[model samples]
Target: MKHFFKIVYCIAILCIADTSYAQRKTAVKAKTTTVNAGLKLPTGFHASIIARDLGVARHMAVNSKGDIYVKMDRVKNSGGIIELSNPADNGIARKKTVFGEYGGTGIAIKNGYLYASSNSNIYRYKLNADEQVEDTGKAELIVSGLLDRGQHNSKSIALDNDGNIYVNIGAYSNSCQEHDRENGSKGMDPCPILDSAGGIWQFKADKQNQTYGDGVRYATGTRNVVGLDWNNEINSLFVMQHGRDQIGTMFPQFYEAKYADEIPAEEMFLVKKGMNFGWPYCYYDPMQNKKLLAPEYGGDGKQVGRCAEMEKPVVAFPAHMAPDGLLFYTGNMFPEKYKNGAFIAFHGSWNRNVTGQEGYFVAFVPFKDGKPSGKWEVFANGFAGVSKIESTGDAKYRPCGLAQAPDGSLYVSDDNKGNIWRITYKGK
Candidate 1:
């Protein structure tokens, strides 16, 4: 009987050890699953769901207090700017507030003021000591009566340390065609659209009720710029120009479908005063690495023509990436290699039919002394969460905007589902 009891006791010990080991394995699996739950980031980087259901969240800005203010492409409950705050560092916003009555794609905080823009106007609200907007109803109109002729009028903004605000006025027509993208139609020479559109304008950040006439035309000949930033190191503006479209549709004899899909590269320009980027008359061709005369302007796809004299891009990217946000890293929390580099949010392409869809990711361009030093890299990807995205509708999340927090984390906003992801680096 004693020997029988001893055998039973040994069996019980074995059973308990096996169960404990199983439990530990289950815990480790749960942790692995949780860590990989968000968007796929660079190794050693983690992305967490910070805010969701923000109603078409666009560009955003982080305040000194670590609060986030995001602009909305669609008005939610009659509000536009969404403020998210989490003082506990819990990786999620414990409080959410909505303010402002306009919906648009520009938001930034500068020098005790919060700035935002609609399609045709720019406004500013005073910030209190807590780095929050004092009153949404007291928004001061900085500029009004901007040209908003329906297409590409996002009016994205960037601020300089010198009290100037830069706002983009995108071209209404794709290439200033005589009949608007019709085959066999010639381009309107001297492109009348450049008068009120196709460039960035400088306005006073503190001025009120200013019109287009009050602002100075800072840069010209950019097709349509949604992503722009002020590089303090260079003390100049940098803009991502969305390349023109429909080369095959408008001039099938000159361009094949594949060439049209990938010919003109999306350009990043170091925009300075009186700089012309050769819009309507020329475009940057990545294959040849030269400015080619646009098909609408009396040349084949390979002709440089007068385009040889236009200002060239600092660097060119693949065609139709639709960069909507550009940010220069100046935070100490990131690696030293990332300091002063540029992060661009490619909002994804809509018309790259031949090559499928591309550019639903954030890219990093290493900059040294305010110039691009190395090739661009894909920093944050997997936002679409699909093997292939043939159409824009097939994308689950389209990255539209990027913001860097005070603590050096990055914030990405999705317009498709209005989700905000905060990415932080915590590796050796």
Candidate 2:
């Protein structure tokens, strides 16, 4: 009888051990099934999918009441801007509403108003006390009649605290070439496109029915600026310009295919009034760390030439990364290292051949006293969810916009999948 009882006791001990092991395995599987499983973030950061299938979600803004407004790159489901509300504070949104008629890539919330942009116009809608759009039909045109000849036509916008709105008017030409991207094509000196486009224009934020004539050309010579922000810390405007393309195809004599793939660096600049960044005239060489005259403008890949006087970039990223969104981090939920730093959503490179496609992720540039202080690091990745992509269509998600919520969570939007991800840090 003593031996029988001892055998029974051993069996019980084994059962308990097996059950505990099984429970641990189940818990780990549950974590892996969460929305953030595909995302790779910092040590304490976690991401949750707040909404999906919202239709070509581009740039987005978060209101004080935690409502999300996203601009679509195209008119999907008969609308352009979509709003998400989550009164329960859960990761999932309870109500989704779509409004606005124009599709674009910019959206913002400033001073009791929600601002969005189409390819050719900037529109503003007044927000109610609950921070929702009062009426989509009452949307006022803050600025209209900007150029939108299709190539580089996104009129991304940013607003300042001083009642000013900044709009990007992209140049239609690739490099203002006389023949437009043709080999041996010469550039048009005094590029006529700069007269009305290729620059940032400042206008009144509250003024309605204003045209391009009413706004002042704030700065000149940017090729195209999709990523722009008013840095409240520095009390100035900063812009990221999409560099000119097709170096080898146009000027193979001076540039090999490999060199063309990585010659010009995408630039971010602290744009000031009347500043010239030398588009259609110069391109920054990341390896040389110097501005060289463009091939169409009489450069042989080594000549600084007339581009010597052009303003240099504050920080230059790798070529073809296609930065589409810029936000200065002011939230406290993140670690102290991220305060006042710049977060850039690199919409990813589509034309890479030599180094393969890159930049479908979000990067962080540490800032000290309103200036970039360290090397830029990839903060969020796996939007593409693949190790390598042969083309842009292979990417699962292309990050297009970024916004910080009032409660300090960060929101990222994807134009490819129309998904919005909310990232938060829960570390104590």
TM-score of each: 0.91, 0.90
Task: Return the number of clashes found in candidate 1.
Answer: 0
lDDT of 1 by residue, 1-428 (tens): 99999999999999999999999999856653466444677788877777777778899999988998989986787788888894327878754678889889989999999999999999999999999899878899999999988899899999999899999999998999988777778899999999999999999999999998899999889889989999999898999999998876778798889888886899999988889999989999898899999988887988999999999999899999899889999987788889999999999988887888889999999999999999999998877867698888888888888888888888889988888888888884
What would the C-alpha RMSD of candidate 2 be, to one decimal place?
8.0
lDDT winner among the candidates?
1
Q: For residue 223, what is the lDDT in candidate 2?
A: 95
RMSD of each: 7.9, 8.0
Flag clash pairs in model 2: none
What is the lDDT, from 0 to 100, of the residue 145 in candidate 1? 93
Clashing pairs for model 1 are none
